[model samples]
Target: MKNLYEKRIDQTKQILAPLGEIHTRPQFGGYGVLADNVMFGLFLQDELYLRATAQIEEVFHHHQMTRLRYIRRGLPLTLSYFQLTDAGWQDPTLFLQLATLALNGARQERAEKQNRERLKGLPNIGGYLESLLLDAGISNQEQLKAQGAKACYLKLDTDDIPLSIKVLYALEGAITGYHEAALPAEKRDELRSWYETRHPTATTKYRR
Candidate 1:
């Protein structure tokens, strides 16, 4: 296996040299091909694979490129990397296009990972808020970002959980990844405006 891989690595480097500085390293039981610090291709199971994204997925599908399927932890898995089509392999210009699209997808994936990491560390958003978000069909930081603070707050209100002003600020805090009280004045005003619109004359009642 090692002997075969050394030859493939040399050939891949030569093929990609015209594009720019290409680097290869081992990861996930395969060798990754990187250009300008972004991995855009891979070698696995004696096949050359390229990263793919929705923007250029149709081109891959049109070529009928086989998707990489493997088994990990006894579970069948599929990755976005697809085998290089014969035409793309033969055409350096087309291969560069594919590699560019793949790098865009990699960057997006990296940004999403950072967002999820930030969400997990949110100060006031915990299991309770997560459940409320789930009930509101707004799971994950991506969804929370898309729905905006006001929309998520109103979605939770429909669940009849006896919420109040604190919950509004909490949603804003979750989106900001800070404690509820730490929100900026402009953001707090936006949340308060939305809350006042919904509850015109409600007073904060402890109901003790």
Candidate 2:
């Protein structure tokens, strides 16, 4: 098994070395390469493959490379994986295109990771409600009022927020908390009191 793994790693290195530095590491019981600390591709059993995104899937299709598939429950599970054609590996331009796609995918993955990490540090409802408000174009209390409660409630409904008045109060609390200074003192206090009344223990607890 070790010799097989080493052979696969060596083959991957030989193929990718010319393009740029390829950093090999074990992942998912196979080997993956990180180009510039961003996973660009993988090697499985001496077969080299690049990461496939929606944008690059077409390129892989054009080159007649088979989409990677695995059997699950006696059914083929085919997703975004694409086998690099022999011509694609030899053609520097095509190799670069694949590399570019991988890099973009890595950037997006990293950004999402960072967002998740940031959310991990925040109160559960903080980011979620902020995102909801941002999606509704209600960055401040003034904007929320401009939209009116019905419009805001409708938008919240579209987002699957419950129609109950209690949920509306929670939503209002979230909005006010995020835009404290923008909200009137009385409205902010009212929302805070409503929230505390609903969940008295939440007043001092930081459950994230």
Candidate 3:
């Protein structure tokens, strides 16, 4: 026997099937209704809610949709999803149109999220080095590029963090998107010379 939630999921999937490949996955204490692998709607307590992006928020408002909210630890947390009103459920065409808007919003959000490049995603950058860079005021890839490898190394050096020629090579590799060991011989030699000049007795490799 299908439970109410499961039955509702089937119904929602049927209504949203026109948009393409409708499916549900466990999420946020309920099920997330996705169209073509993009999350655009949510199901909670047998109720449906559409994702409300900024541009389509006014449209949701026009339909008198209620935003999802729940109390946790005595604090109310309101989510960005708006309840799919009775009118939407009663009218298949309107429901599909609203769902299409939700799908577009979800795609835009995904695209924007993918555009946010992360420094840790770069070559030769691990959690420890990323933390050191963050402490030295370099956060994202854009900030890392702006600081450059040499300037970033100098910042770490000033912080009295035990760093070596390898650390410099690593930073350079990260900036240039190359493996640290694959740095050019000339670049390696150049960095080694710079390090020796800066610290005559420092021989420990980057704090691993």
Instruction: Give the top-scoring candidate (TM-score).
Output: 3
Local lDDT at 9 for model 3: 78
Q: Show model 2 residue runs off by greater than 4 Å.
A: 1-20, 72-75, 112-208
Per residue, candidate 1 scores C-alpha lDDT tens digits across 111-181 of 56544644445567777777556433354677777777766665555322336787778777877776888
Candidate 3: minimum summed lDDT over ten consecutive residues — where?
70-79
Per-residue lDDT tens digits of candidate 3, residues 18-136? 78999887655677788777778888898998987789999999999988877532335456789998898889888988989998987886667456776689999988888667534
What is the C-alpha local distance difference test score of candidate 1?
0.67
Lowest summed lDDT over 10 consecutive residues: which window, candidate 1?
Answer: 153-162
Most accurate candidate by lDDT? 3
Better of 1 and 2 by TM-score: 1
TM-score of each: 0.50, 0.44, 0.55
Query: What TM-score would candidate 3 get against the native?
Result: 0.55
What is the overall TM-score of model 1 with all chains considered together? 0.50
1-208: candidate 2 lDDT, tens digit per residue = 5685576566555655655677876643356677766676766666656776666678777778787665432334343456666776567577666666765775565565444433223222356655554433344445555554434544444312233444455445444453323456677566556445534543332321
